[model samples]
Target: MYHALLLLVQKLSYEVEEQIFSEVSLAIQKPESYFEMFKDRLDERGIDSPIDELAWISLVDSLLDHGLAFEIDWKESGLYICDVVDELLDRKNMACVSWEDFEDGEFDELPTSLCLNKISGKLKEQAISLASLDIESDCYVLITVPSSDTDEMKALAKEAGYSIQDSF
Candidate 1:
């Protein structure tokens, strides 16, 4: 089974952090009401806010403000959202890689240095990506790599002056 991992490195203002937490908590606890409140926004984005997938939806919602969102198709293990900052949008320095990329063997085209696998854990041999690096406003970067590649990711993170804030 191939599982997906999500990682975020950013410093949030206390107000923004609190808002995200509260919104996500509400979405998780009362998905129906939460969906209703954000229905128009979600609809504008063409996302289906199903109550059963509250956890995933809430995560997506929380990150939406940061210009990040993941469209997860659970039944198919599909991840449809992959956004990278403009300058490094090529295959070599992609900010995000979609499920389609994996199915299409795109990872094989990456250099070995960029190819990362989890060093330990149930999620082994999974390909990872640096995803996004926002240095200007937030000094934030997002990584979607497997646990095995954590050391390499950490090294890169350190060089970039970002400490890991959250991982999933």
Candidate 2:
């Protein structure tokens, strides 16, 4: 059930991510109840991971408070969600994938073709894009790097003058 929820959240269309928060917020105002709703979902499935449920609840709250309305282009949002989901699944897999199966010693190695400088630059690009959006100062940036490379990426991110979230 937890896996299914993860998949559903991951499969959430980009527009849904952008719009559902507002819709849900307007549909339901009580933050405590909102949390309970998610907790209920997890409880219904007998999922034991409290942390995971809390993460989703927080994400929903953050989305609503920030006025993150979905972009109108269905195709674009759909594609964006797909990419986000894929990235998420990859990160999820990294937590379980064995080190021996990894070709390189470093599981966190940036794609060889994608230069580290470019990847770091892209984070800045995202930072800029996010600023153009309605995200608040307290809004957090969630980076899902390979589990093996999380520490290094996090350090690099900090060095680049960007704050990184340690947890979702």
Best by lDDT: 1
Q: Candidate 2, which segments miss by more than 4 Å at Cα?
A: 1-13, 17-19, 23-28, 41-56, 60-103, 107-168
What CA root-mean-square deviation does each model show from the true structure?
Answer: 12.7, 14.9
TM-score of 1: 0.36
Candidate 1 lDDT over residue span 1-168, tens digit each:
001212222222122556666665666578788888788766754657654445334544565454442222212111112223122233223233233434455654543223322111112333433332222222223434434455654554455344332222
Quantify all predictions' global Cα lDDT against the true fold: 0.39, 0.35
Query: Model 2 lDDT vs. the true structure?
Result: 0.35
Local error of candidate 1 at residue 23 (angstroms): 1.2
My TM-score estimates for the predictions, one after another, are 0.36, 0.26
lDDT accuracy of residue 91 in candidate 1: 22
Q: Top TM-score: which candidate number?
A: 1
Candidate 1 wrong stretches, greater than 4 Å: 1-15, 45-49, 68-83, 86-168
* lDDT of candidate 2 over 1-168, digit per residue (tens): 333323323333233554444434422345455445565554643544444234344443443333331211212222233243235335334222222333343423433222222333333332311111111233333233333444543444344333334332
lDDT of 1: 0.39
